[model samples]
Target chain A: MENLIVEGSHGVYFVPYVNFNAETGECELAGESYLEDTVLFYNPLLEWLDNYINKKREAIKFNIKLTYFNTSSSRCLLDILNMLKDFEDEGGEVAVNWYYDEEDIDMQEEIEDYEIDTGLHINLIPSTDLVKHQEDDDDE
Target chain B: MEANNLEKKAQDTNKFDLFKYHSLFNQNVQISYKGPFDSKVLSVLGTYIQFTIGKNPKASKKIFNIFIELAQNIAHYSAEKNLFGVEEGVGSLVIAEYPEHYAFSTGNIVKNEDVIVIIEKIELINSLDREQLREYKRVQRNLPQREKGNANIGLIQVALTSANPLDIEVTLIDDKYSFFAITVKVDK
Candidate 1:
């Protein structure tokens, strides 16, 4: 399966970055998401997750690094997380990592909420160090 | 005693000068909508305000966010439901341009019993400085997620984006309902 990459207007669309890899079983979503059509944007992503989980052949690692999202987007996010939770319940190996800006207390809380909402252990990774690394990569 | 008298005279003179300046600054514009907030209208107006004010990108984003949040709040929660089939929520939204900044205000009828909770929430948000407000939002976000429509994150987002305290006033309309007005300013 090829990766899904769509460049969206940050702060306009609820999810700014999305990377779903079929071969690597790595999915990453980042940035601010406040999409006009929440259902339309999320449906395909949901289908991909469902396929990954149902196959039982792919080990998945999902990463979320969203700074801001509206309440509507939050509901849709919950839907996505619950799907992953169901997969975990079925004895699938899945790891979810959430990266937030160090100063963004709100983002930290959001990750916690997702953990509570999904019953999945989300690795709350602070982005300050990771951001510096990413910047160094860019320089290279 | 002499210093007090001199201060009084100075204040009176300053008030008179301010009144004269206010009379000279006569530029005012009022845009009002009564019905469901048409996204079409909002989009056009949002662009117009951005261009007219020549606001920075960040400020423009904040204004747009505030507009969308407040309009949605009215659409979803306003007690005065629109009778017309075209509009789902009935309320009045106004945006006025002042010399220094733009004032965005919204008013709608709310159930009397619900007024206290809304008022308290607004008051709590308004009283906090930026740091406290950020902490409060963090605390609220960490709580267990609700099934649906339960997170009050909208208010927090509005406050954060605008970088201005929320101004909320409530007036009793009747035994069952009250008029709630909320206003916030966005700098150019």
Candidate 2:
């Protein structure tokens, strides 16, 4: 299966950088997500996940790192999380890691709320250590 | 008796002053969110608000949050539709600035049945002092999670973040739908 990649934009519609690999079963959505057309923006991502879960049924590792997102984006995020919840219910191996800025109290609370809303165990990772690791990767 | 009379006159003057002040600063920008509220439009407008109003971080943040929450509310809940061309909610959002603060206002057509619930929630928030509201939020946060799209925490967050109580006014547009208008203030 081919990987799905969308080159992110920082305009009126903020697109979150996405990297979904069918081979490695790794999906990452990062950056700010304030989309002009949220439903359209997220529909393909949902379709890809559904296809993977139904056909390939692989272990998926999902990572979310968003610094800022409007309330409209929050609804789309919930939809994505619910999809993942369903995938997990179907006996799929799923792990979600939510990276947030430690100092942003509102963001931390939002992550907690998402965990409550999704009923999926999400590891809340601080960005400091992750940034350092990413820097190391860039050096290599 | 004399003091009571003086107090009454003072109150009347205060009311007049408030009316005059609001009228003077009533210049507003109203935008309609049809299809997925264009994030590009939002960002550009948000930047303009920030630049035009002068950059005080707190004020800017309040305006941004208020705009996002109000816009999303319309995008998600507006009952009127123009067809499948755009899955957008029909609503109007207005941003007005006064010398002391900026007022964010949103109005949209909603089912008449939902008005009571919305009013009750706003009244509940208004009834609480800041500390109590904070505690209420904490309690809500601790409660077992509800289904997605069921959470009513947006208004609470708006009240808390803006440090202002939500002021809502509802008008009966027709038998089936009511126009709900909510305004919140952010100090400059």
Which candidate ranks first by DockQ, i.e. highest? 2
Under the 3 Å rule for N, CA and C atoms, how many clashes does model 1 have? 5
Residues A3-120 of candidate 1 have per-residue lDDT tens digits of 6765545322234667888888898877666666666787888888888777645778988877656766766687888888888888878888888777755456557766765688
Task: Give candidate 2 regions above 4 Å deviation.
Answer: A89-91, A128-140, B1-23, B26-43, B49-59, B72-103, B106-117, B124-164, B170-181, B185-188
- Name the candidate that leads on TM-score: 2
CA RMSD of each candidate after superposition:
11.1, 10.5
Q: Model 1 chain B — which ten-residue stretch has the worst lDDT?
A: B17-26
**Could you give the fnat of all candidates in order?**
0.11, 0.37
Candidate 2 - CAPRI tier? acceptable
State the TM-score for model 1.
0.61
lDDT of 1 by residue, B1-188 (tens): 69778669879887555555445433554566666655555555655554654445545555666776787677668888766564546677777777777788889899999998987888899899976876676566556654433246678767876778888889999899999998888776
Write down the DockQ of candidate 2: 0.28
lDDT of candidate 2 over A73-129, digit per residue (tens): 666677788788899998999999999877656677777777766788899888754
How accurately is candidate 1 docked according to DockQ?
0.11
Query: lDDT by residue for model 2 over B1-188, one digit each (tens)?
Result: 69778669879886554454445443453332323443444566665664655466557756776777676677667887546466667776667667788788878889999999999989999999976776676556445434423235567777876778899999998899999999899887
Indicate the residue-level lDDT of A26 in model 2.
Answer: 94
